[model samples]
Target: MPEPYALLIEGGTIVDGSGERGFAAAVGVRDGRIELVYGPTDQIRAERRVDATERVVTPGFIDLHSHSGLMIFADPLHEPKVRQGVTTEVIGVDGLSYAPIPDPTDLEALAHINAGLDGRPDIAYDWSSVESYLDRLDGLRPSLNLAFMVGNSALRIGAMGWDEVVASADDLANMRAMLREAMEEGAIGVSSGLDYPPGAYASTEELAALTAEAARGGGFYHTHVRYDLGDRYLDPFREAIEIGRLGEGPAHITHFYHRQTFPDGPGPMLALVDDARADGQDVTFDTYPYEWASTRLLIMIPPWAQSGGPVQTKERLADAGVRDRIRREMAERGVLFAGRRAWDDVRIGAFTVPELIPWEGRTLGDVIADRGDDPVDVLCDLLLAEDLRVNQVTPGPWTETLRDFIRHPIGMIGTDSTFVGAKPSPRTYGSFPRVLGQFVREEALLSLEEAVRSMTSAPAARIGLDDRGLVRDGFVADLVVLDPERVRSNATYDEPRSYPDGIDRVVVGGTIVVEDGAHTGARPGRVLRRGG
Candidate 1:
C-alpha cells in the first residue's frame, strides 16, 4: 500500500476560510499539500497525529503589506510572524526593494536608505537581478513564504539614474521593458511609494504607462497614494484611481484608514472606493487595526531636500543655510508627513550608535527641550550622525473611523508593519489577534469567519494566489490551530513585542513550524511567485 500520511490533525472545528459557517472535521496532510479533509480519522494511519480537540483550525494568515524583505535574511526563523500564524507575506512594497539594481553600488545605497524602514541586518548583498534574488530567498529556507513585487524606485534607478525628473519617451519605454522582464522572473506586480523618491518623482502619466505593462502580465497596481498632490486629502487617492483606470488593471490601495486630522470625513473616502467598484473598476484596500504608524525618519523631510540621492541629501543636511530654510518650511507646514497631526507624538527609534541609543524610544519634542535646539537642528544633526538610518513612530488611524473600514465590503488586512526598531508598531506583533480578539470577539464588528476570510482568502484573491488562503482537500498545507475563546493580542503601543495569547500550532508545507505558541525550528516556507 502507499506510505502512511505525513500528518493527521483531528478533532478541530474547521473554519475552511470560505466565509461560511464552520464544521467539525479532521485534516490529512501528505507530501506538502492537504491530502484529505473530512470527518473522523479513526480509520486513518499517519506518521504523526495531532490532537486538535477544543481548537479551531483555519488557513494560515496572509499579510499583504510587509517590510521584512531584508530583515528575514538575518532572523531566518522569523519568530514574530510565524508565531502569529502568517505563512505568507508580500514584500517589496512601498516602492522599495533590493533587486534588479543593475549596479551593486546603487543596491548598497538603497539598502542604507531603507535601513530605517526595512532594517539593515548583517547579511550579504549578493544578487543584482530579480531572478537571482528570488533564487537566493528560495534557498534560504525562510520560515514563511515571501512574495516579491518590483518597486517603482528600483525600476526608475535601473532605467535612469536616481534623479528627480518626469520621464521622457525613451525613459518610459526602458522602464516598461524592465517591468516585463521582472514579471517574467516571477514578480507579482508594480509597487509605488509616492512619498519616496526617485519613484516619487514619477508623473501620473508615467505611472499609468508602467502599470499598463503590469496589466498585460496579469498583475495589478499596489500604491501608497501620492500625498503631496492636489488638496493633499482626497486628491492623492483620486490620482491612484485615475491611474488604474488609465492603465486598465486592478488597483489596490495599501494601508488605507481614516485619521482625525483630516478636514474631510471618512464618509467621502469610503464612498469614493465604493463608487469606483460599482462603476466596474476592480479596486480594493487594506488597513491595520492600530492607532500608531511607523516608518523611516527621512520621509518627514521634503522631496526637494532629498532630490538627487542619499549622498546629496546628506550634503544638504550639513549646510547651515539649508537647515534654516527647511526649518522655515516645517513651520509653514506645521505638521509632519502623512498628516500625523503633531510632532511631539512622534517617537524616534532604531538608533544604532551608543550615543543615539539613549535617545531611542524618546520623542523628538523631549529631545529638543533637553538640547535647547530647534526641531530642524535636532533632526538634521541626528540624521547626519546616524548616516540617514533612523526610524520613527507617529500617531495613526483613528479607532472610531477604523471600525467603519474593517466592516467595508472590500476592506482587508495589511499591518504595514515596520521591522527596524525595538518599538515597532504594535500591529507588527498583534494585527491578526487584535482583529480576532477585539473586533470580532469583543465588539462583534464582524463575524469570526469573515475576519478569517479577510486575513486569508481576501488577500490571496487580491494578490492572485490560487492554491492558498483556504482549507481544501487539494490545497497547500499551511494551517493554524487556535483557541477561539482565548485568542487575543497582548501587544500594545508601549509594549510592542508580546506575542498573541492562543496560537497553538502552525503548519507550513505540512511541517510543524510552531507548536504550543513557540517556534518548533522547522522552516518549510517557500518563495511564492506569480504562478506555478
Candidate 2:
C-alpha cells in the first residue's frame, strides 16, 4: 500500500537527538517526513532499504555559525560539511552577509571586505534583499538547508553609507524598519559583528534599538562580540548580555571562547554567562573544538583606519604617513597580530594576489624574518596588494580551557568555518566529527548522547527550527547514520581538505543525499524561513 513508504533504515540504534541512550529501531520515511519508528522486530516494508545494523542513527548535524553564504552558489557540492553529517547550516553570521543592499556600490565594498572569508566567486550580483537572496540560493539547490540572519553591517551601510558617524534618530528608525522587514521577509534573526565596521561603528544604544525591533518580529540576536582578547575582552561579552536584556530576545554568542590573553581564564568567562542567565537573560553560546581561529587578516587594522570601506582603506595602506600611524597604533594596542606574541602564531591561510601564493601556509613571522622587513609594513603591503582578501589562522586558548568551554551546559557547536581558503582550518571539515571522536569517545569529556544533543537538537532549538533536528515520527527526515567505533575526522591542521570517516549515510527531506560515505549529488535542501 502506498508503495510501502519511500525508504526504511533498519536495525540502527537511534540516538533521537534527546541526549538519552539509544535504542534499536527501524525508521520508515515517506513523502520527506518520518512515517514510522518501529522496533527492530517489527514487520516494516519500504521501496528501499538500508542495512544500518551497527550504526548510530541521529538527526543530521546543524552548524550554528557558518560563513558558507558567500560561496554556496559557486560551489554547491559542499562535500566538506555533508560528509560530516551537517544537513543544515545557519549563515549570515558575524554581522556580515549579502542581503538587503539597496546600493550596488555597498554590495561591491562588502564583497571586497568579505572576500577572505567568502571567496570572490564569479556570479551575477543581482539580488538586493533578504527575500531575493534566499530565492537565489533556492534556485542554486545548495547541498544543505540554509537559514539567514540579517546582518547589522548591511543595514548600516544601506542607511548611513560607510562613514564613521553615529546614526541619527532618523537613521536609527530606518535601520529598525529594515530589521523588521528582513525578519518578516524570512531571516531567522539579526546578527552583529561588533569588531568589524560599519557594525563596529554602531554604538550600544543603536544596536539595542535595532535588536529590539528584531525581537518584536519574533527573532533573536546573534553577536560576534566586539573583542575577545586583552583587558577589554569581558566588556564585549557584557555588552552582548546587556543588548539581549534591553532588546528582550534570546542572545546567542557565536564562537564563544577564552583567548590565551585572558588573565583569569575560562572560569570567569563562563561565570559571566551564568550570571547573565541568573539575571533572567536568555543567553547561549557555541564553540568549535579547536585550538586555532581563522579570520580575515585585515581585522588587525584599527577601526578608524578602516573607516571609508575597502577602497579608502587600500588608499590609506598605500600612504606612508598613514601606514606608519597604523603601525604605531597597532603596536601600542598589544593586539594579537600587532604584538610580538602573535608573530609566530599567525599563519597565512589564503591570499588573493598571485604573487603571495608562495606565502600561503607560511607563518607571518617566517615571512618577516626571511625578508628582514618590518612586520607592519609587510602586513600593510599585503592588505593593499590583495585588496583586503587575505586570511590567517592564529593560535587559540589552552586545550584545557577550550575543553572547559565546550563542556559547559549552555555550550553548543559552530564551525565558524571559511571554506574558501586553500589551507582552511581543520574545523571546516571536522568540527562535528571531532566532537564525537575526540571529546566523546577518546576523552569522555561528554557522553555520546550528550554530544549528539549539542550538535543536533540544541542548535535547532536555539534557532527555533521546530520541525527538524530530531529522529522521531512526523519530523522532516534529515538524518545521519554513523559507525561510532570508526567515526572520526581525518582532516588535520596540516591537511585540512580531507573528509571524515564512518558517516555511512545522510538523508535530507527523505532523499538520500549521501550514501556509503560519498555524496549522491542530490539537492533536497530547502531555504528555511523563520515562522514557516
Candidate 3:
C-alpha cells in the first residue's frame, strides 16, 4: 500500500461541539473523514499533524438562517462565513429567495425583494422552478455546505404576480403545486416574510394551507412575523404559534427579539417565545449577538401604499394626496416615530446607488436633518430613486430580552446579515466573535462552553445535520480551533468589513481553509443538500 493516508490533530482540548466538557484528545483523519478520537500514540503513520496544544476544537458552525444565498455563489471564498468557523449556511430566508421563479419578470421582482443580494454576476434568469434553483447551487461549490427554505413570497409571485389581492382557488392550487415541487427538490422547509409583501398580502388561511403542505413533507414554517415591534409584537408571536398549531408544522421565528417598539427592551419578547415553547407546538428561534437588525427601507411606507408594484408605489409617493395620507397614517400608527428614531441609530449598511454612499454611515434622521427636508418625504424619494431595492442596516440596543433569549435552552444563533464583499454588514463579520468575546466574556453572560454550543451543536441539531457538529469518531472533520481568551470580533459599525481575531485554524471536511488566522485560499467546502 502506498503510505497509509492519515492526518493527526494532536494535543487539543476538544469541546466536541456537543456541550460536553473539554478534554485533551488526538483526533485523526483518514479518507477525508474523522477516523478516531483518543489519546495520542506512536503507532499510526500519518500525512499531517495539527498541533492544537492550547486550542479548543469544535465542529464547524452552521448558520441556521442567513441571507447569504447569492453571495456564496458570487464569491466562493466565503470571507464572511468560513472565517467565523461556519462550514454551512442556510439560505432563502425571510420567506424570500432568488429561486423557484416561473418567469423572468418574477425573477426580477424577487431580485428587488432581496436587494441585499445584489452583487452576484449577471446570470440568466433561466431557472423557472425551485428544483432548478437548487440544481444551480449544485453546480456552484462555494466554500461550505448549504441548505434552503422555499420562500412563500416567491410562491405567491409565481401564482399571482405580486398582486395584493387574495388568491383565487386556482391561484391557491398553483401555489401549493409549487410548494410541493420545492419540497420534492429537497428543501428543508418553508419561510414567510409576513411583515413584507407579497407574503404580507397572504391571509391566515393562505399561510395555513401552505404551511400544512410543508408539514406533510416533514418541514417547518420559518417566519419573519407580520409584526415584531411595539403594540404589534406579542400578538404576531401568538399568531405564529397559532399558525403552527393549525398548520401542523413547527414554527421557527427569525431574529428572535423586539427592536422598534422597545429598542432598549426585550424582556417581554423572551417571555413570549418561552410561552410558545411551553405550550409545545415545536417553536424555536435564532439570534445574532448585536443590538441592531437590518432590512430594506421599504418598510417605512404605509401598508395600503405598498400594495401595488414598484412603479405604482413611486407614483403614489409623488401624489400629494397619497403622500399626506401616508404621513397621517404613519403618525397615527405611532410606529413612524418609533421607526424613524430607530432608523436614526441605523445606517445604510449596503446599497447600490452612488448618491446614497454619503448617507451609508449616517443615521436616517441625520440624512434628512442635514438636508433640511421632511424625513417622510426624504424616505419616500429615496425608495423611489433607488427603485425600491436599497438595503439598510438598523442598529439598536441589545436589551435584557435578547440576553434572556440567548440563555434559553433551545435558542440558537444566526447572523442574519448578508455578505456583499467589501460592503458586508457588521453582523456578517462580528456576530459569533462578538458573542464569544464581548457578550459572553466582557458581559459575563454565558460561559464560553455554553456559547460555543449555541453556535455549533445547537444549530447543527436544530437543522438535523448529524455528522458535523461534534468532534468525535465517525464525525465529519469540520472544525474550528480557537484561543478562547483572544477570540473577538473586530468589525465595527462605521467600518463593517473588518475580520475577527483569535481563530487559530479552520478546517472544512478535514481540509484546512484558514491557517494561523489567515485564509489558505482553499475551496474544500461543499453544498450540503438534504438527503444527498
What is the descending lDDT order? 1, 2, 3
Candidate 1 local lDDT, residue 198:
84
**Which candidate gets the maximum lDDT versus the true structure?**
1
Compute the lDDT of residue 359 as modeled in candidate 1: 88
Off by over 4 Å in 1: 337-341
Per-prediction RMSD in angstroms?
1.6, 1.5, 2.6
What's the CA error at residue 528 for candidate 3, in Å?
A: 2.2
TM-score of each: 0.98, 0.97, 0.92
Query: Candidate 1, which ten residues in sequence have the lowest lDDT sum?
Result: 334-343
Candidate no. 1 TM-score: 0.98
Off by over 4 Å in 3: 1-6, 116-121, 228-230, 263-267, 338-343, 349-351, 420-424
TM-score of 2: 0.97
Assess candidate 3 and give its lDDT. 0.75
lDDT of 3 at 299: 68
lDDT of 3 by residue, 471-523 (tens): 77888888888888888999887677888998888888888888898888888
lDDT of each: 0.88, 0.86, 0.75
Clashes of each: 0, 0, 2
Ranking by TM-score: 1, 2, 3
State in Å the error of residue 255, model 2.
Answer: 0.4
The positional error of residue 354 in candidate 2, measured at the CA in angstroms, is 2.8
